[model samples]
Target: MANVAILELSRNCAKTVEEIVKLERKIFPKHESLASFFHDELKKKNSGLLYLHVDGELAGYVMYSWPSSLYASITKLAVKEQYRGQGHGETLLKAAVEKCRTRKVSRIMLHVDPLRTPAVNLYKKYGFLVDTLIQGYYSSDRDAYRMYRDFDSS
Candidate 1:
């Protein structure tokens, strides 16, 4: 049986950030990756990162930022190829959402490649609805779906 753990990263954890950057490079293209700005992102007051570990090995991570009191954005979610299809993405996402909820944000948002069916389905399962199609959001030839989930604040 695999032992699973989800941890909220602290801003000053350099070793963990290094590991996350390595995983980010493996999971995303250079143009879309957060590797170069990850450390700086963590330094922001409203940003947070949640990482997953399976049997002590890094499996995935989610980065989020609540820039304002009313909304939060999931900036990135990535799972190592070896860990794909094993529910690590969902775990990371759930944690990110819950974190935002605890902050009393009214909505959560993210952008995803429309062609990534599995990711789109996962977001849908979590109640995120597409807000619009972003032209060249990822690149000149790639488009993205801006998705969001609103919480009942009343």
Candidate 2:
């Protein structure tokens, strides 16, 4: 694994949005983030968008929103094809977890396609437990597992 840097994107950073859009297209064509959406999220205080770079090249990104509460929810997590299995995904997730802790969130949650075994395993390894099965989460043909990791076990 290479030394990767994670950056919290800013609204004025055009390059960050461009790179994120490209990576999103490559890694998740069905769920690509538009430039406008990136701009909006970057401008908001309750939302966060983070990108991971290896030697100045964009490798992956993670987006999450707190939505006026102490609950953190992950909107997207993606790594370029070439960067998968190189720990970038886990690194991104760790960063998100830390952010949630910094914001004093009670829990971090995310939805993942049931068929995405690797992602399911990764979340489980980090102490995330399946909360429920959401039918039509992505679409009528797709189902999702709602997973969460709570900071306060009590």
Candidate 3:
């Protein structure tokens, strides 16, 4: 594992959005974040954007939203193609879970393409169970699995 730091991003960090977009393009070319999208998310009180820096370079990011205190939803998770398999993804994910815990969120959930076996496996490793199959969740051609990890905060 490389020396990685998980940093929360904000609108004040002007370059952060560009770096995140570049990493998104490399990992998920089909879905890149627009400048405005990042801008809006940063302005939202309920949203979080965290990036994993390996050796001080942008390596990956995980974005999530907690609409209420009861639940948190992971909106995005991506690791640079070259940096995959180095535990960056897992680190980012666990960090998100902790964020939710701190917020007193009872459940954390995310949607994943069924084809992304590695991601599904990682979620399972963190005790996420398949909650349901969402038809055409991503697109008409793509289906998704709604995974959930419930916490016993009591």
The best candidate by lDDT is 1
Model 3: per-residue Cα lDDT over 81-124, one tens digit each: 88899898999999988987888899999999889999999999
Residue 80's lDDT within candidate 3 is 86
Model 1 alpha-carbon drift over 4 Å, by segment? none
- Tens-digit lDDT track for model 1 on 37-152? 88789999999999999999888899999999999999999998888998999999999999999989999999999999999999999999999999999999999999999999
The number of clashing residue pairs in each candidate reads 0, 0, 0
Task: Give a tens-digit lDDT track for model 2, residues 1-154.
Answer: 5677999887788877888877776666454345446676667788888899998898889998897566899889998888899889999999988987788888889999989999999999999999999998877888899999989744
Ranking according to TM-score, highest score first: 1, 3, 2
Better model by lDDT: candidate 2 vs candidate 3: 3
**What overall lDDT, based on C-alpha atoms, would model 3 receive against the true structure?**
0.86
Q: What is the lDDT of candidate 2?
A: 0.85
The CA lDDT of each predicted structure is 0.94, 0.85, 0.86
Q: Candidate 2, which ten residues in sequence have the lowest lDDT sum?
A: 27-36
* Model 3: CA > 4 A from native: 29-36
Model 3 weakest 10-residue run by lDDT: 27-36
Candidate 3 has what TM-score?
Answer: 0.92
Error of 1 at 61 (Å): 0.3
